[model samples]
Target chain A: MEALVRPKLQEAYEAVKRALECVHFCILIANCEVKYWGRASSKLGRGQRVIMLKQDGSVLVHRPYGYEPVNWQPPGSRLSAELKDGKLVVRAVRLRPWEELVVEVYEVHLLAHCKLRDDARFEMYGSEGDIRDLLANNPELIEKGLKRVEVERKVEGGSIDILFIDERGRLVVVEVKRGTAGAEAVIQLKKYVERLKGELGRDVRGILVAEDLARGVRGLLVREGLEFKKIDLRKLFEVSKEQGASLTHWLTRC
Target chain B: MEALVRPKLQEAYEAVKRALECVHFCILIANCEVKYWGRASSKLGRGQRVIMLKQDGSVLVHRPYGYEPVNWQPPGSRLSAELKDGKLVVRAVRLRPWEELVVEVYEVHLLAHCKLRDDARFEMYGSEGDIRDLLANNPELIEKGLKRVEVERKVEGGSIDILFIDERGRLVVVEVKRGTAGAEAVIQLKKYVERLKGELGRDVRGILVAEDLARGVRGLLVREGLEFKKIDLRKLFEVSKEQGASLTHWLTRC
Candidate 1:
């Protein structure tokens, strides 16, 4: 790892250029102006921003206020740094779509580069797919006497996330969403239900399953004659744990 | 700005603690294990990762490979650093909804802190709203003799983005998407058109307008007897530029 704090412009530029050659993850705190051109063109005036150059050729220029980067270039970009007319210019370009991001640095506050070795596998629980799998395995969690008939059943419009048989022997088309179910999710479930009803020649029940419902979603579901089921992540985790999955140990160890 | 490279765990922990007191944006490259418990539970094993603590109380744990952070806490998280049992521990917690992230550091590679000042206003030229406004003013770009009637007119399902009267004197419901028009956008436009048709007792045309269409979207639009318009962002920018907007100056300066 190498770091320079309040270094000269020439020194900082040389260090960044060297870091890019070695394929190290570089961080630059600089007062700079950024210009991006490609799908659309944008210009950001001179300001202090944190610029990150990743080993995967990704570049992120973040301002102080927001979570999203003001300007970014995705992975597989060609990164180059040069000192032209006493200003360090960092350019990232992609070839196929012809996108370019140029950062002209007038002053450098801090520059650091290091070889990062991150091979850790990230495991996340309670995603939409996880919810679908859990509900498919344990249909009773969604409703009593609900039996899972098929997972991802293909119909006319699209695939049903989970097909279930209710206690009354009626077929149910389930649509699972991770965080919040909105009007779009409701409309999607309606399309799947209508398609299935046309093919099966029977009245198919539609259920929109998600952890939470967005504003006006409940009313939309009600108007469409659909049902909403709230999914509990904690209970899903517990159910997976009882089945002796590795997630239990991972959560408990944490 | 202050930076420490290859420092001892105790010294690095003290530096982080002092930096947190001064509310500086701190960056740490370390081999650490991360655990997050909030809306969901996640566990990441010990590996080298970039940890960023922003002045806005946002924490991002970035692995070396991807654009998104493996673990992140939004703005307004309480950050604290400590050395416990010969290891550095960094924790960030949020009060609302009770979310907590713990980073147990086994080795510190680089630690840097600096006060960042960024107040530049970000300007994006091409967005869904921008496209809608441009089309509302120049409805002929959509179709010849198409006159826009209302912008965001309220209907039964939701607000129509732009309502236009076509050359044939039929009402047109235009749903504008910035990037790619998909199945959801098609459904939303259909709902608006159907609602208007039922209410006004007139034939209404539905048009899905976007920069591009996703796979199968064209076929879906044809099956529904709807229309699809490919929006040209470059042409829109040129039109906005001719109208003497600030976007022209910004792009030209870049």
Candidate 2:
């Protein structure tokens, strides 16, 4: 990791381009405001936040309050920075799925490049198939009266991670992700819901069940009329073990 | 960040999906090998390395020996995991770019999620532009005979950061990046060189000058027929001070 402290305007300007071009992930901690143009013009008030630019050209404007970024540009976006009129104007744009971000630099306290590595080792014992099989056998993992009808349910576009029958006997397609769910996973879940709705000849609800969700994904899920559920696999496994269920059997079956 | 110990197979499976769905960056440190299928199939022998899945769906397999990952999948790739015959098979694929990665996990030691944040503040006194300007004014920074012709030269795609004439009187387009330069930076430099090639009516050499270059990017620069030059801004600033040159003056002039 390399740290840059209180660089000049031109230095900061060049840093943005260099960071974007070099694929060196950067976190710009600054007290500034953001302005957006292109599809719809908007502005954000000055606040202390972190602006993370991944090597793949993704940009995230994150405030200190939440885990989600206030604004972002997806991967593969082209980033440009200029020191114009004493302000560092940083812009990121993508062509195919059109998106744009413009950040006006008012004050930059610190900028650092991170060489991310998985430093510590962790032993992950359980498997996704284990969760699926557990849910398939035990509906209680979801809620009382809701039962899982099938595991790895196949659909038109792809396979649904889990298919369930709610308390009211409504078909539910559950998309599972390990850590925090992002916009991509939600979009995928929406597709599954739409596909299942047509195939089942009825309305289907989508539930994105993950250990956690990115700051903004919950809003997206609600807007898309889907549900978000946080499930802890480690705890779930402990509970299953207390019930004396055969995990090895479930693993084999899955 | 969450840590699990010797989790059941099902727990592990669910963890992978949850991690991928949720945007929590994951580091899978395992004693295993990898097999990639897309964009030219290849396999890596068994070794101890870290497989990092970023919040943006990018995957990097890094070994301890080098700064760059042995294999990587760019952001926006779709990752899927399955437990087949007791082996964890992880796959990541991208459509538009046509890339795929498959990792067969024979054994797993640890899996962890990192909540990345800048814990400390750093003050970068001088700037990359200062180094560029100093190098521009003082050819000795690069070599004795290299002289900068233009600070920011206009080109078709965009402006080349710097244009210099090498010792051999050959045109050299310089792209300066902070910290470590990656493949993306090299690719951008390549584009600049290609554009300059037609306009200059001669072979325009390219030099990616940065604080450091990532392990993989060096090879890329060589393969692309470009040059890699390391320029330490801190050292250059110190040298400028010794020369009695006012950095503030040079900065304002640049």
Candidate 3:
């Protein structure tokens, strides 16, 4: 379902069929005061709030800014409602891991419901090889005086994305990723550094590169004495073209 | 600010003017393989990967299905690009928490860049007050023969969301949350139950009700000998309306 505008009470009823259904989406607006009775009572004075409902029987009462909802009901709950003394009442109940949600509505302005589609497939983008070629030819695109000495430099452990010689005459092993770098990437880079160090008979610095780094990968890189670089891939292609339509040139040759 | 597609290399260069400039969003499609060289070496064989770049200098390469990217460079990284041997080469470098990303593109299909807007504001939602009112009137909506005897029944510790008498006439103390029911809710319910048990002159069984329960809240409920119930707010509202057009009747009376 796309969207619903202001819905009457009956329309609201039709929107939420059952808790066991796939998923239902509903939005509600109301102006009313509330007080809860349980281990204690909480009183919310007369005001307006928005209410969202899901088909799985989940509900959320949201406010501004904060991520957490003001009130909510978890999924797998039995739901029912009624009106008492002119106020709208809603109730949700569950058996196992039991819970309940009761809402009182003083005024209702809009109730929107929608059904989300889950069968849509996302479009595929490029691949890892494309990123590699872009970075290999333009070693200086990463750092000044950084010269790309070799591509796919083989090591006992694996392969280096680019073998570079910095202006300081130091061997730099470059690891490139076209995707978000994870802890696994850090570990992989460390392995290459170790292998390159033995072959060169000198300390070889390692660089872990990717489009994005995951939450904890950066911290691991620091501990392992490694470096990381971010690349604006689109810029790489753009700069390469300005350097002489290299991509078009390469594509034609390939 | 919107989107740039199939831009020339110069356009790409102009779009990514500086590392410290405002955020930029770039999407690149490439046919590329990737490798990591640091403490180790890891290779991602030739395949398709979507590379995403942000003005914050963060980049992500995505494949399919997985939530995390195969490789990434975090923010605060200096970005540079160049063309080498016909390949589009891109690199990102960072000093503090040092890191780097080197991308070599074998082929490029698309390069899309956009600047996102931050002026959007979300709408508000209904509140805890509504839930409290809904449950207060229809205690049975939570549990059969459960009568809400009082609201915010206070004890020495705190107020309970609801005070009820079950079918067997035993006191049931309920703690309600309009939001996620977490460890805090369990603790709060336990305090109310302990106090209510003393004042009610009989054993008090506690139940915690909320829109949803968080990770550890259930374990806490078990430890405290309390029960949990999930609520579906929309169904509750729907059921209430079917019971009677009470809301409309009340509105008309008002």
Best by DockQ: 1
Note each model's CA RMSD in angstroms.
15.3, 26.8, 22.5
**Candidate 3's residue-wise lDDT over B1-254, tens digit each?**
22233445554445544322544545555555554332122346555555556555655554422222455555555666665676565666655534455666666544534343222232223466666766877664577557778987667756777888876678998777876788888888888888877665678999887768998668878978999877655444433432342221211111
Score residue A94 of candidate 3 by CA lDDT: 51
Descending-lDDT candidate ranking = 1, 2, 3
| Fnat of all models, as shown | 0.49, 0.00, 0.00
TM-score of 3: 0.29
- Model 1 Cα lDDT, one tens digit per residue, B2-76: 788888999899889888999988888899999988646889998998888999888888887555567777677
Error of 3 at A156 (Å): 32
- lDDT of candidate 2 over A1-254, digit per residue (tens): 45555666677767776776676666565666676543333467666555666666667665533222456665567878787777887787767535457787766755655444333332223456666665566554554445667788788878999888775668988887766789999999999999988877997888887778998778888999999777765445433432442222211122
For residues A1-254, write the lDDT of model 1, one tens digit per residue.
88888889899888998889999999888999999876468889899988999999988888765455678776778999898987899999977657788999999988888788888777666567767987888675677557789999988767999999886689999999987888999999999999988888999999988878999789989999999988666556544533432221221121
**Poorest 10 consecutive residues of model 3 chain A by lDDT?**
A245-254
- Output the worst ten-in-a-row residue range by lDDT, candidate 1 chain B: B245-254
Interface RMSD of each: 14.0, 24.1, 23.0
Local accuracy of candidate 3 as per-residue lDDT tens digits, A82-122? 66676666665655434455677666544544442222232
TM-scores of the candidates in the order shown: 0.60, 0.31, 0.29
Off by over 4 Å in 2: A1-254, B114-125, B128-130, B133-254
Which residue pairs show collisions in model 1?
Answer: none
lDDT of each: 0.80, 0.64, 0.58
Q: Kindly indicate the candidate among 1 and 2 with the higher DockQ.
A: 1
